[model samples]
Target: MIGSTSWVIPGTYYENALLLEGLVDFVELLVYTWDEDTKTLLFNEMDKLLQLDLSYTVHLPMDRLDNVIRAYNFFEEARFPVINYVLHPIKGWRRTLGEKVALENLKELIEPHNRMVFDVGHHFLGKKFPAHLKEAIVEIHAMGVIDGRDHLPLDRETAAFIKGFMGDLITENVLINFEVFDLEDLKNSLKVWSDTFVE
Candidate 1:
């Protein structure tokens, strides 16, 4: 399904979620920061969040396992039904929440159960997802890479690529997350995607 990152605008997750309720099929919750205020904001808004007509996938914190555990605990405690948990390869990382984790690129893991979340921009840096790993991709982080930068707003060419060679993941059912952080980026990406990336 088509989707956008949770922080499409500069706002709290709940605020962004509310803003994006009907705009996207799902919100890739950018659950990166771990702190009391962030916890309080999300916790207080959890009940209201359930009321929104939106689905959720979670991008767990990439750096710290403690934060990952906290994120998992938060979602589990909230009884959040996430589509998948996108994970970046981390040192000393192990399965924290069963097989729910969709291991992100930048590393190769050979375990049969190891699912994947492919980032198009990251692929620009190197290491395109191998054909053997096709079955493992559960999500696509769709965005652009200008110069040496990645995850910028998707231009028409990039959007076209998203549904073509640059994206064109084997799994047709996998989620296509805009993965952009700005509102204008999301708007442009969506329009360009719908216009050029015909299903």
Candidate 2:
């Protein structure tokens, strides 16, 4: 099943509860940066949410490298089968550090997870795409664009990219997500995906 990250509400737990109520077969959790104090609060909140028994996939925080590292370790230790981990190429450091460094770091961070959600927008903005990173996971979800921007809707170019990427990966059932904002975009994206993939 396809789902979108719930970041519309103020608190994570509250938004999560709302998402559960929506009854989507799957949901994406964007667990952003958390300090020690915040982490404690978050854990307590998560415990309450877990009581609901709603299954979900987590999107690791991308604010800082340390945050990503810590989140990865937490999920690993908890043995949580993370559905996908989102990666953002370090801004200014991209040119200097290179995509290889980011790829290595991402591999180390998500070794425990079996899947990944690749944000085509970020990769496009960074102008650094690591083809090798595709080999590290069993499932790859290409996040599509919205309007003229990436990570929103399935535009022509992004659709082509998905087709090409899927061909190169040769992985069965590679998930593609259109990060749409409105109902129109969502409907259009579904049509675009159907037209492109369905016979």
Candidate 3:
């Protein structure tokens, strides 16, 4: 399934997600630091989301693994069925929180078959998507980030390569989130995906 990042929806996080009811299969909630006030707001909105019965996945903050664990627990206790907890293999965090280690750590919080969200662009940053992790991938953050500039539109050659490499995995159940910030870029990226990989 194809989805857009919640950041480009131009509203409160919950409001933006609500707007995606019929437009996409799921919403990857881009979560940041959960300050006390923000945490309250999030709990309230999460209740609304549960009531609405929208399919969702959470994109945890890249800066903190504790936040990721906490978010997962909150959603689990709330009885929300999150598809995946997407993660980034941040620099300097490799020793303590590598992708595999994080997945293992998450196993203590969740089931053995818990899924993960993978970012394709992160592969270029020395964060390789290992063969072992492929079985647990339920969603993907798709974008083109070159020379440290992220959220840039996917270029033609890169788009073609993606179609060649990732097109086969475009099943109806797996979510491909266009994790770009600009609205136009998101739309264009969707079109590129549709034209190139959705056949």
Which candidate tops TM-score? 1
- Residue pairs clashing in model 3 are none
Error of 2 at 64 (Å): 3.2
TM-scores for all candidates?
0.87, 0.59, 0.73
The sequence of per-residue lDDT tens digits that candidate 1 reaches over residues 1-199 is 8788888778888889888877788888887867788788878877777789988898888778888888887887777888788876676557574567887777333233357777877777777666577667778888877887887877776666555663445455788898888888888777777777665
> What TM-score does model 3 achieve against the real structure?
0.73
Order of quality (lDDT): 1, 3, 2
Clashing pairs in 2: 145-152, 145-153, 146-152, 146-153
Report how far off residue 113 is in candidate 1 (Å).
5.7
lDDT of 3 at 86: 59
For candidate 2, which ten residues in a row score worst on lDDT?
95-104
List the candidate 2 regions with Cα displacement exceeding 4 Å.
Answer: 8-25, 36-55, 76-79, 87-117, 128-134, 137-148, 168-175, 180-188
110-163, model 2: which lDDT tens digit per residue?
222223345566555543445666655433344465554555656667777766
Q: How accurate locally is residue 165 in candidate 1, as Cα lDDT from 0 to 100?
A: 61
Q: How accurate is candidate 3 locally (lDDT)?
A: 0.62
Superposition TM-score, candidate 1 onto the true structure: 0.87
Instruction: Give lDDT tens digits, candidate 3, residues 1-199.
Output: 7777777657766787776666667777777754566567778787777665367777666567666556656666777677655555443333333232223122112222345565666554544555565656666667776786656776665577655555466576666777787667877787777777655
Provide the lDDT at 13 for model 3.
66
The alpha-carbon deviation from the true structure for residue 156 of candidate 2, after best TM-score superposition, in angstroms, is 4.1
